[model samples]
Target: MDQLHHQSERYGTDYSLAICDVDNFKKYNDIYGHPAGDSALQAVADSLASHGRESDGIYRFGGEEFIFLLPGQTPSGAETRLVRALEAVRNLGIAHSGNPSGTLTLSAGLSAYLPGHRVSSERLLKEADMALYSAKAAGRNRLEVAPEVRHIVRS
Candidate 1:
């Protein structure tokens, strides 16, 4: 969120911020085991790495989640990249005897800090969370945009 704020303040334009979470990761891991979980994580990471350009920054936010930073990128652009990443992960076809076909999926929440806008971290995270909720509600493998965007600082 800070990164988005920085770029917005510096360039006076909005950028993209997304938080991706692996769907049913815990159950998938339990079926395959910890090693399988690690493999899944690596696969997701690789997908993100391949989809992102040099300007994009990807970070593993602990387990089953990733934080993506796209500097100077619009919301639509970020969505495009995420779509490719999601597909790449799906096509990976990871081998596991745990679940049905041993496959996995991901969900993402995306938000844009449009030009001439300011936001607080709390509000930013909340919007992202709302987006994520929508994604999960829609389906296991999908992305959702925040219902609304607003500016406010965390108290």
Candidate 2:
């Protein structure tokens, strides 16, 4: 967040941050046991790591949630990368009978930090979280971006 703020203030660069959660992760733990659930998480993390660029930062936000920072990327670029990441996880062929897809899946929420705004890291995270909730509400295995969260001055 400090880096993102510095990049925005000093370099006038815009970037996107995304929050991703594995769908039906609790079910995986319940049905397959904790060890299998751990393996599944590792696989998902690998998928996310493989799909992201070296410039991107991937973080585990506890449990089945993750945070991704895409430096100097626009919303569209971030969305594209997320889409690929989602598909890569799906293609991993990890079984999840608890889900409708019958395979592992992820849902993400993305929020962009535009230059010349007074946005805070907390607000950005909240926006992405809200978008994530929307994605879950709409059904998992998709990405959603919070438009209103971008380019707003801090109050």
Candidate 3:
């Protein structure tokens, strides 16, 4: 978080936060057992790390949840990167019979720092988190950008 603040102030570079959750992870665990679940999580983490850019920061937020920070990126750029990352995971072909897709999937929420908005890192994460919940509620295996922060970006 402090890195986010420092980077923004020092470089005036836009940053985007992505909150990701393993879809139907609990069901996967219940059916596949904890060891299998751990393997699945590790696979997903590895896939994400491989797909992410060198400039991006990946973190295990907790449990099946992961967070990433995209520095010096615009909203559209962050969205594009995430879309590709999701596809990369899908291509891994990890079986998840518990999910509708029958393959392991991820749902993510993204929020970009607005240059003039003075949004705090905590608030940025909250917005991303809300968007994440919206994605899960809407249905997993997708990504959502925080609606509240949509207008913060200028064309």
Candidate 3 at residue 54, lDDT?
A: 93
Q: Which residue pairs show backbone clashes in model 3?
A: none
Q: Which lDDT tens digits does candidate 3 get at residues 75-153? A: 8899999988888888888888899999999999999886665578888889999999999999889999998667666
Model 1 per-residue lDDT tens digits across residues 1-155: 57557656777776677888888887877787898789779878988898789988898977888878787877778889988887888788875454343567778887767643356545656677679878888865788777554231111
Q: How do these models rank on lDDT, best leading? A: 2, 3, 1
Q: Which regions of candidate 2 are displaced past 4 Å?
A: 116-118, 149-155
TM-score of each: 0.85, 0.92, 0.94
Model 1 steric clash pairs: none
Q: Which stretches of candidate 1 lie over 4 Å from their true place?
A: 1-4, 95-102, 149-155
lDDT, each prediction: 0.75, 0.88, 0.87
The better candidate by lDDT, 1 or 3, is 3
Off by over 4 Å in 3: none
lDDT (C-alpha) at residue 150 in model 1:
28
State which candidate has the highest TM-score. 3
lDDT of 2 at 27: 92
